[model samples]
Target: MNRSQYLCLTALAAAIGFASAHAADTTVSADVTAKINTRTMQKTTQFDRFIITYRNGTTERSSATAATQNVTAAVSRAKLHASANATAGSALGVTWKRKLAIGSDLVRTSRKLDRNEALTLMQQIATDPAVAAVEPDVMLHAVKDYVAPASASPGGSAPNDTNFPLQWHMRPGNGTVEKVGRDTTSFANWGGSGASSAWPNYDGSGVTVAVIDTGVIIHGDLNEDYAGAGYDMINDSFVSGRAADGRSPGGWDLGDWTNTEPYITECLDGNASAGEASSWHGSHVFGNIAAVNNNGTGVDGIATHAKVIPIRALGHCGGYTSDIADSITWASGGHVDGIPDNPNPAQVISMSLGGDGTCLASDVSGTAIAGAMARGATVVVAAGNDSEDASSHTPASCPGVVAVASVGITGKRAFYSNYGSTVTVAAPGGGIYANDASSGTQVDAGFVWSTVSSSTTTPDQGTSVTGGMAGTSQATPHVSGIVALMIEAVNEAGHATLTPDQIRLALVNSARNFPNTPDHPIGAGIVDANAAISAAINYNSVAPSIALTSGVAAIASGKAGDAILYRIDVPTGATNLTLRTLGGTGDVSLFAKRGNPPSNDGGNADFKSVKPGNSESIVQTTVSPGSWYVLVVGVKDFANVQVLANYTAH
Candidate 1:
């Protein structure tokens, strides 16, 4: 395997970080530490960055100084090298090597190797002239992988369509007008001037969405309109199997959303809490994405025109990994062997809640998420309510899912929102607790203005008692709703069905870049639903052009500002062209100029810090049908590099 790919595999073992304060920290302690100290790994964080220790007395540290000219780039290279070297070294050192991941480091060692031998090897490596310093390879507590129960039935037919529309597309047929409440921050400021004018047609009709969260209580806004029958993944059975009517519970659950059993009025908050507060959290989230707009009551929804397939997952401190994984797979109509297919399959799944943990791409949760995507489902998740960046939680951190951050009404980031380049976009998740205007707008209230559950009928229950709330949890559904709207527009416009990659491109390309905010906070600006829907309807169906450059140029892997130039002909009035890469971090860039190539010397390049996946566009001004030179540059927080230098005419 290539060096990076090798690093990726090694890193997979350490995919998850600390799950909770109560979880186990490591599996093998004394021997692991002894081995790490024996083999010298990099000492300083600046020079070493990452260190890997194996059971068979092998150690590896990233050579931060030996990589590319960029210091940061070198560190990244060193970390990868450390992992690769450690694994290969362990393979050569012992009869059987086992891989272990501690936080971000991947350590490999022989299962049979004794602690004394490990210590000796470590000491030798530490003293070596090439060695820097070494430290104990710590162990991390994470969820163990759960084995799927054997399927009761044989394999069924795989889905035929590769691109399934987001579920909110089915809302229009539900018969309700769009809701326009007091708050208008999310829809506004998405684009340069305002929201796009694309919501009039195909307002999410016939599409089915799955929302996995706290149980939802049946409410007027939902049962009256926009609600489709759903399943209870936590109960480990179909909706019919779990409910008296064979239908998933719609509103408020005194019982935990994680466990399928009945409510136990025990040691919870009080009489009020069964396990966790079964408030209308999920109901509000569902409404925001597909509440009937112009319903003449309550707030407006992003897509007042779609149907939803609700699946509950939260409860009792937190839910179990096994249940969450099963729900994710089942929601996508995946073959779990024993479980019946979800009565209503969802094309789009939105996870508005998350925990503080670092999970790898191979974790059980990650695997399930990937499986759902493989089945052509669009997974959208909140980065987390926690304010830390890399510390952001999983399901969102999973490779295939689109991780969302939170923004507020004023076009700024929410204080409780997590920020990272890995995040895709920022939606209106509201700000921190109420303080004042000096502390930024208290958007938490205004952010979550949508339909709520009516399960609580007492004075403290129902809409009067349990009202809509806000958080990254609430912001996620807005994007989900918009995704549904865009899918509908795409179908109505008669453009070719878009793949997840294409849908992602449309969202990023059309997103509003928040130049004034921190790059980590807002991501590729806010998700412009209106603009996204418009692009979906009028998508550029042609394949992106790829042509290599004639001369040498630097192509940095992570940087977002570097440009690679190539000559190509431009069609008359061509507005933009897309640049794509097959490997690496899936980064992209855009460039624009007025005239034809050789003639048009004045041009500009816009570097996107994070990889926007398979394809992205360089929106250009009007140009004559003639030859031109276009440059696609790679950029990041540090340097500029080139990937492929090619030009294509739209």
Candidate 2:
């Protein structure tokens, strides 16, 4: 609503320019052009860097020298061009920077290139038989609400448990002027994520979560392990704000205050006043997830007993996608060259950062995410602070991530939350004013209060608690901490940790429905920690029974992300049984098996059917008499859909 929230969209673009090229060299294919434009959001006109993924076993993937040679050849072949302000080479002095951890090459031009020119060059690169994909090396930043410097005053520097009363995002409590001074809003039922309810029950023991952001600094409220506590993965020394050049071991925030010359001058896209205060953003996010509880100081984290491995991905002027990808890969126990192996890999990777554009399958970040998921680490990301469809954001739209949206204390979508079907669930991200207010006026307690720094430019000597921050950044860690609890609850009981897919489904299935209809669809509803923990514990529980050609033949209702299970008993001499779902205007996936429930992974199931709409069928020609389990997961919301099983006995 304010100028700060638009920082991700309008403020990130810097000075623009154009290029001179033949009309024939102006574009790639139409489809590719459209995607490139979408990623840029037309907000950014300058592009000088690119991330190129080459197929495995290819020469480019194996040899960095070979990769650079390929890009140079592409520039020459495509009549390489730069932005209006840049024209310094065969292609703006195209130079290969480094190879990414995911086996992708990071190439930089001498200067910026306009969108079309960048697209034309990328198209040329893709034309290589070994090239898998290539695109701009996009920048992703922390997603906290942008507060104007004048309004962002440091709150009480109290190092005790005083500010816990104002943490409405953690538990249920109506906001009133009497309780929180100068806040004129009341919602009798302020149903929060049930995190506190599960506190006395589960404390997320023996689980490590990777907090990938600006890096968690020294704080009294936060507990970080010495070994594998994460790293400073930022590649550029200028963006990192660290005196040393190479990424070091400590994932500490040396301060990313971007009001200086190069930072201010470069960050001037649409934002005239782009002087942002150093947030200590990573520490804030870390506090929300796993800050020590009952420590007689500050606030309580959702997963009180969980440990955080803060992976520093963003600093100064946001961060590069390649750095974030490397952090993700290393955090989840994957390999990243030039960086030591993480001794303590996390069970969940909490990312409160992202940038414009939906994730392409070949995106380096998306590929890293898939790798993390394959390692059984649950990845959670913020939907974004830009109040647009989350489908337009990275990580959020990426497959295998539990994308979270923001809800206010009243259980409505936050004014700045990005929404859409991509969001996996919602959590309290705080609204400084009433939900109807486009932009918040003035209310300190209405924000998501947590551990923050007092100094605007550098470390404030010690920590402070400020009730002056809110966004999908706050919402994401709540879910991550809960996931930690879920993992702990299951693992502490001597059970193997749930797979990332199963964990995602359990979170989706256990969510309590939204109290009010959202303007756009946002997963199941506000996340319920109590319900989700129970759901994880009972994930493999026996399925409810239904009769095939005997009694109740149909189930008529479902919501997206709901994987409802039922079983049917066939009789002796049974010839065949046909199970199908129809009469619905929403997407649904059907899976069935005789003895065990089938996985709805599109494969790995005994028999499955996944078409477009609710019309899906699984026909077993040769059937045996037994309890046959069926799993019906809503790919989209369904109203009066009927899931029925028919049989042929001869």
Candidate 3:
């Protein structure tokens, strides 16, 4: 068919399909094709216009207007290379779009173009004298999918919230069906990171985690945890506004619903399937990480005490990678041209969105991520849901990032989860595809439940809606929350904040072994919250040690109440086991115990040396073959506290 005929037919089909699906509140997928040439009617796909980065020191001011003028002039210069008949006004059909808010020099095109056209335009734009580099704007989507069950009901139970019980991913296994014919009983306690166990000690207070995804909604359940107005990076004038381009304050969900009558006509490349109901994705993600707890209303979040800095980068039909990259930089307190300096810099950045490409150091997202890491923010990303090797996805495949894969309540890799060497750990991402085949539709029992909203427009516009969502998108926040808990623990212990590498190591090293082997190998097993907190609190030095026959000795130093850990071996028939603390002006107490230390402080110690002053002594007459732990707690701040242990061999 001719190009005109093809466009007319595609629009007609899309309109009919959308009308039918709209009446039923259902979704339909359709194949769309566009004629690039007489021989090539390629699939109508999305590609960003040329994004050109100018060399540093070329522009005096990094404002949007300044960047726009510079790029416009460059485009004019590039037009000289166009066909001799090309007019200055319409050469290459390129128009100046807004300058990127995150990167000062980068500028985008005014309209989306086909991949080949965008590539050709980029090549022409690269010839400009001022252009340092140019690349196509790659599209990224929210790493979440909303499955509308045949008969769905909000499930979960908390004292105040009625939907806490449905959140099986947040608790130990509850005998739910996570996989076909498999009950999660074997992995009952393997879910979550034992976050509840660490609740009493650290609720993630005084920590900020930036949720970089679709904008968040203001749900009642998230009120206390909401930090403040976050920036919206969707620069489309139609979606946001002309004045809001580059960015505007307030991270609000503007309803991503598409495919309806009027909206279907605006579908990219005339594809109807690209439209979807508003996922409220950012709200769900943030809710999983920092929903208010003990409020007598909703499900508890893993890091209830932590606040979220919601930065909206994804919108209808997903978002552009350039916007997301900027959000990452700005959220981590990096400078972005148009936006004001961030008042609250996030210590952790949680990205539950990704695209289908390997991350390259030269790419915009990679550069932004590196900046965030340099600022000491721990980045957590979702492994794609394509069920392919995670190495094929960006951010997840990026170096120095904690790429989390999804696991069902059964402690196995979720059927839809991507896995491979790129995965850093696994968390419960919910899989309700098994067991009760009542109506043949997967039930809501196998999903992560979190805060949401009913409105398709305005922030916090509709009644609060909390329900279950399944994907690596849901699994990502669990790790982010656990990271918050780890940070809180480390901060409370008066230790230096952990670097991104250290935090990644602690989580991987402390993950619980999987109960059963998974179809794909995911990270170091599922994340263990209690264990992660323990690992963080005892990070670098201060770790439990083994005592030798000559009596392993070392000088422990820290602020007041700091605990130094040591262990001694007791051979079979061994008798004397002596532990002591000496040579310090500050009072230090010694406690001896066996096995792992208790989760709480109330647990009893086998031996205690509580002296009124600086020195402490302990001797155990009855010692047997096994490992024993000695805890040296500083009663007062001490620079050097000598810790010594002696155990007799059998």
Best by lDDT: 2
- Top TM-score prediction, candidate number: 2
On the 0 to 100 scale, the lDDT of residue 229 in model 1 is 50
Ranking by lDDT: 2, 3, 1
- Candidate 2 achieves a global lDDT of 0.72
In Å, residue 495's CA in model 1 sits off its true spot by 2.0
> Whole-model Cα lDDT per candidate?
0.44, 0.72, 0.65
lDDT of 3 at 371: 86
Model 3 ranges off by over 4 Å: 1-48, 57-89, 93-104, 110-112, 126-132, 148-150, 155-159, 173-189, 224-227, 241-246, 435-441, 456-461, 541-650
Candidate order by decreasing TM-score: 2, 3, 1
Candidate 2 segments whose C-alpha is farther than 4 A from its true place:
1-3, 9-23, 26-41, 81-91, 146-160, 173-178, 181-186, 226-228, 269-272, 435-441, 460-463, 541-650
Q: Where does candidate 3 have its weakest 10-residue lDDT segment?
A: 1-10
Clashes, model 2: 6
lDDT of 3 by residue, 514-552 (tens): 877777767777888888888898887324243434376
- Taking the tens digit of each residue's C-alpha lDDT, what string does model 2 give over 45-85? 67777888887889889887898888888877757545454
Runs in model 1 deviating more than 4 A are 1-198, 223-228, 236-276, 432-446, 454-466, 541-650
**How accurate locally is residue 187 in candidate 3, as Cα lDDT from 0 to 100?**
28
